[model samples]
Target chain A: MTESGHSSGGGMTARLVAAPRVRRGARQKVGDIVLSVVLIVLSLFMIVPLVWLITTSVTTRAEAFQLPPRWIPTPPTLANYAEINSLIPIGRMALNSLIVSVLATAGALLTSTLAAYAFSRIRFRGGNTLFSVLLAALMVPVQLTVIPLFILMRTLGLVDNLAAVWLPATVNVFGIFFLRQYFASIPRDLDEAARIDGAGHLRILFQIMLPLAMPALSALTIFLFEATWNNYFWPSIFLQSNEQMTLPVGLVQLQGAVGGGPAVVVFAAITAVVLPVLILFLIFQRSFVESIASTGLKA
Target chain B: MSSAPVAVSTVRRRGIEGRSNLAGWFFVSPAVLLFIVFIAGPFVAAMGLSLFSWDLLTPARFVGMENFTRLFGDATVWLSLRNTFVFAFASVVTHIVIGLALAVAVNRPLHKVVQYVTRSAIFFPFLISWAAVSLLWKYVLDPDFGIASYYLGRIGITPPNWLIDPQWALPALIGIDWWHTIGYTFVILLAGLQTVPGIYHEAAKIDGANAWQRFWHVTLPIMAPTLVFAMIITFIGAFQIFEPMRIITDGGPSDSTRSIVLYLYQQAFESFQVGYASTIALVVFAIVMIVTLLQLRLSRRWMGHD
Candidate 1:
């Protein structure tokens, strides 16, 4: 984009366009070659640890810490993967993580979008004040509310339950703030037109506003999914039972179970834990990165 | 559809009052109820709990100011407070410097491909779970059969026990903390870097400014708001550090690495000192608030990156 902009501005009018075009082509090729080499080297660094993790996971415990590390395991096996069930309820933990993440993401998106819509379009007494307080709520560290939440859950007899982990996280200030930032940008004319057609507020939000909010909603969903999936602290404290552990907590359990196993096994456990998230990231790298980047700028 | 809300049930004069106020309340009821019960109510309850010293087993008794008074006299709590502050500040400083450096280095227009790779490589660590990173580093830094120690031993240097020794443990934990979250800071900083137009750099170059001069004069000011914003988040996150210490040291080696959060966790969970733990949590909150205000005051003259 930068190079094209420079070329378009500098050489198009004075010199023959063909000569400048050739120079631009040469520069672009040179740039691409350098870029490819650099990217490959960097990409290798990003990928090698992952490759090592996979290799280490499949290798025997005895071969884990050979004086010189083995890049590949001969006769690779799934013994380590199989050990997960015997060691702990690893499959159940994965399911718990999936359930909690999906439910929290859905709940968060619904509540936040409703609140965001109300804040963006509706005018009520103390509405702006409430919104300002919510913004301040974003800056309040999670720890402030965490202790209170624990007590609340304990009092409600909801401790050690998945619902305890999912409820508070569902109504986050950041989600409201994020969706509001986007929703505020949506033109209000369509909303007014819908209202004139006798469409109610809920109808406007669903039929008119939501369709235009696909980009922001998708971004929010991706962000929420990643966050809830990776969330550790609340679940750690809330879910005391092994069966209820999420992937992050389960990985910790796996680490403990190894009880000083070969480095390869530990690496394997970590690999198992990180794999799903990494795959998801690779698939939605653009959305993952853009959601965060756009949100940060929105702040 | 024609019978929607019994539109014709009421007489014309009273029809305006026919709409259910309950419906509007119902629309927002779930969120309002959850927020009050889970957030606002707990926060108020915590404040009240901070004033008492109940262990959840004995009958409730009020002990106003005793818990806070005990906290003042408790050397361990004080030590934990200091350690927590140092850990938080060091990690925040390291993250900002290293993250900003990585962002600026890779933010260059000259090496677009290199920039992409550098950004991706740096961010790769951020995706790794905190426990995994902690375990990986614990092993790597382990004295026996550890890769880091193995390399150091070749030069006839013995590696100190990272999670065991009192003096070295906190620093080791800090180093790992920096590594775990530096990618997050870098990503945020890089996003900020993307917004600064290249035209400013071009104009600076036309003025015959050196690279260092251009960065200090043009880039820094433009990036100030972002730097401040990232710093605030980093400060808060650092102060709340818990997972790694919980996994790696468990606040061991005579409790040198015990952070305020860890102390709170142990107090509440291990000892079941709910009231005392709430008090400690309040102190932690106070510390965070004061430090943030102080930092905001300090950054006012130079920092405007909000």
Candidate 2:
């Protein structure tokens, strides 16, 4: 639990904490092979649902529901893709998701980065107490807040509007906590050196701290974006109509429709919702994994 | 020290402090504003609302403790609580068990590319939204025309109506949850496993300790903190289970799958009892806070003994 092996926000931390691999005996090699076989098969269990989703989305109805489901459609069609929007107006829902995720992530990052700087670098009265208050806010489940938040949203006339989804998201308590940890880990001399050169706190945070804190910042961005994109409950509650819903909410509505609104089309809708995240995962795989792995250190 | 210089330095320090005090509040004001408006305000509202009888359509009427008194006797509340506990217990046990196994299995002298591929494949499912995952599972568990059914049938075991049957619904949700979230726990455990110094295992091996003994003695102790952390997080997340129940079963098959949060939502939105729902929400906060505090205390005790 000590912060000796790896601190919070450094590029080389992962390398430093990684234990060197020891040479294995002949018996262990055989065990490794067996473990590999078992894990790869298990990994297939993890992936097959997604693969089936894409395959089902691309297939015709006949190919989709046939006994012993087809891995690939005989003539994979773009036909279901066309029908998804018509059936559920999923394209509009996706736009709503995109707007909410982007706005919220950007707002969270900006505000949290600023607050984190103040917390880590500046001396102020009641700073520790305020930090504790935010930490307390972090633990109360979002469900607990919804009863009142629903009222607030209604009072603001933001129900059925994307603004409601993204507004409260603008201030992420976890993001502040995370960025503060990362900011605190950096050596004070680096920012002090900037201060000696006549730079203010803003300049120091942007020029020195932020660039160095990119490792944690990007990780936080990925998570904030993912959380915003994937959220189902509040959006489902606040959003009244289909057009205002996020993609996940829309997908549920689609499923609840007649006969689950054609299996092929629903899968197509699901795929569209998952596509952005899947692409982000592929692109930022290392940072994403490292960020998640580093979360253990919080223990 | 000279008194003049000491006084000068004190003045300088006070000046700097004055400036930083302003700057600090300035930087953090946005966050403070948002927190008060969104989180703190809502929490206070929740407390006040819990004491009143209000539906969204009507002005709140003072009815202190009525909702709370009713909470103790509601059959659905107790049923959902039981189901949630069972689900959380199962989730925590399974996640830690499988997560540790997977991490230990992969902490080996595998090729770099092989390691990356294996890790990515297992972890990929964690990235997909729960909503998408829930919908995709319906297809996978479809009785007549699903791959699971097709495969299980071939093996001479019938796959039950997963999301429908009351007996199978909760278990099926647990299975799907494991598939979706175990990767996160696996990654945490994996990181913990990798941080264990190679020298300890080598020393254990030199003492003629077998793999199990080395793991049970050395690795398990080293990874205990990560295990505890993952267990608490997984349990908390599982306890708040909503998406799958809302989308998949709608808390059906005799209300067997209705989670506490889902039930709260039903009361608040469907039944339009905001006061009762706020009380339920308080119950959730209390339970989570109590459990988290209990976990921290127990972990402290256990770690102290260790």
Candidate 3:
């Protein structure tokens, strides 16, 4: 973009252009190469541990324990992966994680979009105050609220239930704030035309607004799903029983019990936990980066 | 009488204005209800609970100012608070410096493939949960037959028991935390960097300014707010550090790595001290707000100078 921009500004005097262009060539070429090298080095630093993780996961337990640690498992086996089931209810836990993530993400999408639409478009009694309160809640860290939530769950006889996990996840104050901003940026004229055609708020949101905000909404969905799936703190603290525990919590237990001795099992558990999100990120790499980038630009 | 009833019904229904107001309420009610039930109501209840002593099994009995007074004298509280500050401080510094460096390096007009690989590599660790990354490092840093020991031994340096030794444990956690989260800060700054107009650098160049001068005078000023935003979020996240200590260290080796949040959890769950935990919760809340406000004030001066 920068280079193209420079070329398009060709209207500048030849001397001005030529001087910098020459300097840019010599200086920038050297600088960029330096930075490129730096980038690769940093990239390698980030990737090596992940490589070690995958390699270690595939190795046999005996090979894993061996000194001058085998980078390549001499006859890589899935025995550890098979043993993971007897070790813990790994499959069931994955299903629990999946179910909770889906439910929470869906609920968040529905509730936040509705609230965002109302906040952005409609002027109602107490609306501003309500929105302000929601924003104010952002200052209160989620960790602080857990004690109260635990009590609340206990009071409601939901001490060990998944409800305690998913209910709070479904409504994020930040999500409402973000989608409101995104929805507001959209030209009101687009929705105004729909209103003129006798369309209702629901129709306007679903048909006109949501389609336009799909990129942002999907980005939000990706974030919420990953967070809920990867969440360990709340689930670990609240859900005591194994059946209700999500993958993150379950994987930790698998380590505590059977993963104590076999390094391979531990690595395999971590890999299994990380793999789904890694694959999703690869598939949606462009938009995920864009959404994150765009978020930063907002502040 | 029939006409009167009809007229009253029409006025009550009141066409677009009334109906639209109802619609607005309907739209926002779910979120509002969630706020009231989960956040607002629980917060108030917890505040009340702080003024009383109660185990989970027993009925509440009021004991005013006891938990509050107990909080200041608690030695573990101070230790945990100090550890939290240290962790948060180290995390913020490392993340901002390294993340910005990575972003600036990537932002230069690199090849498309180079850009993609750098981004994916940086973000990959961040995608994994804290539990996994913490455990992964715990294994990697295992003193016996672990890679850290193996490699460092070759250089004739004995690696300390990374998780067991008090001195090395916190630093080890700090390094792992940096590895896990630097990507988030990088993406944020990269986004901010792109928002910097190319023309500013060009104008600076035309004035015979060097690269450093351009970055300092032009780019830094433009990027200050975004950098502050990144720092604030990173600090908040760091301050709430729990998973790593809970999983790997278990707040061990003379209580070196016990953060405020982890301490609060143990106080509540392990000891069943709900009232005291609520008091600790308030402290956490107060500290976060005060520090965040302080950051905002400092950022004002920071941006003003730039």
Candidate 4:
């Protein structure tokens, strides 16, 4: 009887695990199929407009206006792309955007990393209070500061220059916060060992800490680059001259110049302006999603 | 000899501490300087500028409390504030509900390729700049020769002139904003959902809890903090909505869709009422701070984090 009971107990344990699997399999199959269908519909909602934009870019002015709008361009052509360049130096504006965004990203990464290292590793007087004040700065809207900043830029003769668009943005609170958290996570013994080897604070930060924090730095770089690249409001306000205008501000002028003309040309201009950043995003999609997700969770 | 060595070590320690302190200051100086010059200085200047009237062309004159009083009486300010609140509220609600639903759907047991493709498709629009999004929608929503109109007509419904019709303009902008931004919220919620341990669901299932009960009891509580974070950020962003209105409608056929930021821009640039615009900016700042603080306080009660 004892042997039979032991055999029954073993069977009970096996059934406990396997029973749920069999039940869940039947239920989850239906759920998964329904969920997949819903997700496909939602994905289409997101993708169709972009596909439409691309199709519209290649369509002729007359075909663009046809009812039951064409899903695919009929005899797709590159004429609209050519027309955009002639109307407003689209290539020059894209280059301007690239230069400003790259410089701003570099400057921000430098300043934020240095400051984050100091804040995370060094125990100076009032450091916590100072860091709190920096955090508070995040809550202040850019709108409140724009008027005075614009005036200050004008006084410094930086208006209508790319400096005006990027200077104020070079010091970012979010970047500092993100990197500081990363620095704090690093083990203290590493810094202690470096100190014993007679490494200076700058040496330690540059050589030891930075290499270990490359993941965080790359994520921050992508975030800052995307933000600076897509920046519109600040560039619009700071840049007045057509020659100094970035892609976003230039696109607005192109829109005004087109004046309800061929939809295809405007579509072409939009596509050209957005394609570089879109490509960058696709390449670094993991970094983009990870950084944003972590920021949200940590905040 | 022992005393001598101890004293030498003491002096060396002091020297190292002092040198490191100096280095700390040096490292942080650039960020501190930029912050003071750009952020802190402008904030104070905005406060001062609101008390004096000056067009960039002329000498400033002090007019204490006049801008504030003028803001109080300005009907356009009231109108813009009301519209902003409506847009912001609708944005927060729709984004949370739809984003959570999307996250739940994607979090289910589905094929790996479908999961990745769905996520990429949903998030693609978010990477594009607001300027491009605003323009793209303008073409799609055009009353004549627009695809939206064409499709709606095919389904036997007349599409209103979206950007022109006062009643539909704000709703149209809201819809465009959802298309532009819901991906961000989805990704955030998806991350949150992934963090909820599967053991809790298994236990709940053993207790014979149904799917809805498990979600309501186990999933919601575990995801509370993330939901709160997403909600607050979404509210903050929605309140600052400017690009769509400025680009598509230009504050509309009847001033129905003018956001507070657009109003401030018009006052400062078009009318040259720099002082009054600063006052408006201050009001916007105060409202955002108070609402954020209030949300934090309220979340504690429901978030179950003592």
Candidate 5:
């Protein structure tokens, strides 16, 4: 994968190789300048909405509604944040989201890694057929399964519970498929050596393969965490009560409850809902990009 | 003594192999169980439910093909389908064009800081949840004091009541969807661009191919598989777009912006037409499957991968 371009030397080598003909006279320079300017503008276009969201969240109600629109909050206040908390249990919703995302991530990682190991390493009966079935499930959108799953959950008396949100998500076929590919890339010699050393299958997986596949695991962890954290559709359906709702679901209820109220408060709630994930992305942007790239490119 | 020992070791090896097989099943049991209970079970149940007429409260009467037939005659179903197709089509074209262009621009050798910042800035919106994005756009497109209307009015072009106007609502939702998702398409294309082996471009240049020719002949062919992948996912996603419409407009302005999923939601929840909704779900499944297969089949012609 060209993800290997993470090295500075690779970039320099590419530049050095392309320097002569690509550095054609003033025309190329102008084109480069234009491309740079366009990219900068597009970048600003992307970032400005987020900037507006943060600014609006802090701005007073009067300032937020101003005709010209203030780019920055004058007399910025955390009052809206307080107001949002009062309107809905933002803290409680955040906690629910945190709990659900954490559990879902852990569950997905465990299931996917185990399944992937079985699929990749173990020569079990019907393994290919089972993997093919799992891959087929990948193409089936969750929305198509939502109605029956809802009924199933109802029958199981799991409605309005966090389990409804995380349970279905626990078996991520993409994660299984991804990790299987990663695990398959590891040489068979290690596992053979582990086996010769009297290491059991579980020991071989845990002690040898799992450690080598840490990058892939970390990537899957970030993907699963972000996906679960941001999931709104299933949570919206399953969690009806205010206390049970995740942040995304709660935000919608907040919008309804505070209809025609101060817009800043809503913005504050939006900011509150979005900030944690944004910070997570900023920290783990590389892994996020790498995982997405690997998935798309490999597929 | 050697034959006896060899036979004993062979038996032990067979025992170990059998144990490993059992271990494999044990390892995969949790995932398989969940897949059965959640995915495969629901899919089969949906098929069965679609064959019956039932609201949650009533005893379901078997109606065979009645729901499917009704779907054919249903005006709102057609309307929502049309809306979904329009949204999906527009999304695919715009995301591809804009994403590819952005990827090309960014693929140029730029300052490391500039590259990182640009990538992060563009991809940031994708990291945010659809709920947050939908609300943020709603605020931005608010008719009364929205910055969008404010800015447009300044330029002597009055923006329509975006979410309220039927004519504007779907377009507004499409624009919001683009804003939220273009980052994903961009990143994918950028990754594809990185894998395009600079030598191809250099080779093209040596053959006296101009920039446009090089891109058309070399860059595009290499990027075709990634492009198709992006397109298929974007279409699937766009067809299932419910969040923006649900949040921003509530599928309002006379249901002009209602996607098929939103319509299905309305049918199942609001109208309590679970059987009919299941039928719709099946339709969605079929459409996604057919479209995906069609794309896959057609892609072989243009895609370099055999």
Candidate 6:
């Protein structure tokens, strides 16, 4: 097959080569080298700003704006980190963010998984109708809903509480739809067999089905955690006191040089907030990427 | 075949139909209850408040359609709409082009490691919050002490004031947005690129096609559907841009960077014009719906890769 196909396309290769055949391999090699060099240089450029942020975070105030731009600090101290740590209660902000993110993830998992099971496994009146409405909700930008959500939260007296942020985010339309698709793709035979053995619907979902769907569940957990961790807008509006601020909002207030102190202090605050998210991504980076790709394909 | 056994099972299933009804509701009640309390409930309340003017401190008066009328006449609202469109358009275009180019360059069949590293590096920006991103750019764009200015001075060209200057502020915001958002589009597009079969390229080569021609005919058509999805998502994200503009510019330099969301926030929360803010939100909603519908419609014409 190779020989036949090569002979059939032999004339095409000749026409494509504007130069001698002996140089073709050499040209392709040169192309690879040049491409590699270009990619390396571009990647470095892209990374330089982030590296600068890390460096500046550790640098003292005086050295932060030093002439000729000190690529590395002379005596890299944790003073800036220490200063920011005390100046703004970074711990409190982190705690607020943690509580909100943790609860939101749990709430999302419980609600979305159940909805997914209902949409995928159960055949009931208005089931498809409900699922379609959920899909349409994905198109409605959350901004459009924020105004109304704020009013409702205020009426419920949930303002300034973590529940204000957690409750609303739990209603993620995309999360429900995502898990629904994943569940639908699971073999129905397992579910049917469980049913024949006198298992109830909830029992089937929690026992046999949930165990088998761990991959999708784990992926959804990571997605939910990251999204909730990084949320800024609602938290900003809902929580009033500095004591209740999430990391994103707290980081904003923590910024700006303090009493002629070094800019590194602000950088330290930024670094502290970013560290957990960076670590989270690194740990689950493969599953995170795979889940995102799978969702795209499923859509 | 197993027709008789299947029939027996069907008869058993019919007998259990009444029992299954309560189970379905039991299984779905938690999600349904949360959706009602959180989403459906809020949506109804928001609409109700939009019809009345109230600041939580004061009693609301029912003023039907008055808020929307005021919203339509507000010039700032109109300006914000224009800024939002320009912001979303410029950023989405640059993101798609840069993302596609990087994906193709790094996706060479021989260098899997290189592809993985480059993609991870690009995707790093996405993990960082926009609040941090705004801080990073603030220093980089600072006119007096920013590295950008110093580099320009070394090259004998005066640096443009990036953030403070009204004329450059929007472009500057766009640049920062692209730097942050290109990663998202890159990942989505790369996923799409991985699905395009290499067999098509070899066939095109056999048919005497040049490099550029092969990309145009084989790679692009196949990636069109993913591209549409990416662009629409990018458009939605761009339209809702708030944090970067709010944190970096604060709608400064004569409010040139005031986005629709920012404006709506000011109207609803800052000015305590709850009714007007809701009207503006409804307008924003209308625009999003129109754009999304247009995207869905247009995807039919050019987005097919099958």
Compare the candidates by TM-score and give the number of the best one. Answer: 4
Q: What is the TM-score of chain B in candidate 6?
A: 0.90
Off by over 4 Å in 5: A1-23, A257-259, B1-17, B295-306
Q: Which stretches in model 6 have alpha-carbon errors above 4 Å? A: A1-22, A256-262, A296-299, B1-15, B110-113, B298-306
TM-score for each candidate, following the candidate numbering: 0.86, 0.93, 0.92, 0.93, 0.92, 0.91
What are the per-residue Cα lDDT tens digits for candidate 4 across A1-299?
A: 22443455668776666666666767778888888888888798788778788888889877775667788777898888989877778888888898999889998899999999999999776677889899877888998999999888989999999999888889998899999999999999999999999988889999999999998888788778888988888998899987898988888876674346756788899988777666867897888898777766655
Residue A176, candidate 2: Cα error in Å is 1.1
- Please write out the lDDT profile of model 1 over residues B23-131, one tens digit for every residue: 3444445556666666667777888888777777786578898888988898989888888888888987898897886677667554565665666666667777786
Candidate 6 to truth, TM? 0.91
DockQ-based ranking, best first? Answer: 4, 3, 2, 5, 6, 1
Q: What are the candidates' individual DockQ scores?
A: 0.31, 0.59, 0.63, 0.66, 0.59, 0.52
lDDT of 5 by residue, A114-184 (tens): 99999998987778899988877777877779998888888899999999998888888899999999999
Pairs of residues clashing in candidate 3 = none
Tens digit of lDDT per residue, candidate 3, span B124-193?
7877888788778877788875677787899999889888899989999999999998888999988888
Candidate 2 docking classification: medium
> What is the lDDT for B297 in model 1?
69
Going through the candidates in order, state the TM-score of chain A alone for each one. Answer: 0.85, 0.88, 0.88, 0.90, 0.89, 0.88
Give a tens-digit lDDT track for model 2, residues B208-271: 8888999999999887777888888888999999999988888988999999999999999899
The docking category that best describes candidate 1 is: acceptable
Measured over the true interface residues after superposition, the C-alpha RMSD of each candidate is 3.6, 1.3, 1.6, 1.3, 1.4, 1.9
Best by DockQ: 4
Candidate 4 residue B85 Cα shift, in angstroms, is 1.0
The list of candidate 3 runs beyond 4 A from truth reads A1-24, A257-260, A295-299, B1-16, B293-306
Q: In model 4, which runs have C-alpha deviations exceeding 4 angstroms?
A: A1-24, A257-259, B1-14, B295-306
Which of the predicted structures, 4 or 5, would earn the higher TM-score when compared with the native? 4
Error of 1 at B278 (Å): 0.5
Residue B241: error of model 6 in Å? 0.5
lDDT digits (tens) for residues B175-279 of candidate 4:
999999988898899999999999999999879898889989999998887888788889889888888888788898799999999999888877888888899
TM-score attained by chain A of model 2: 0.88
A135 Cα displacement, candidate 2 (Å): 1.4
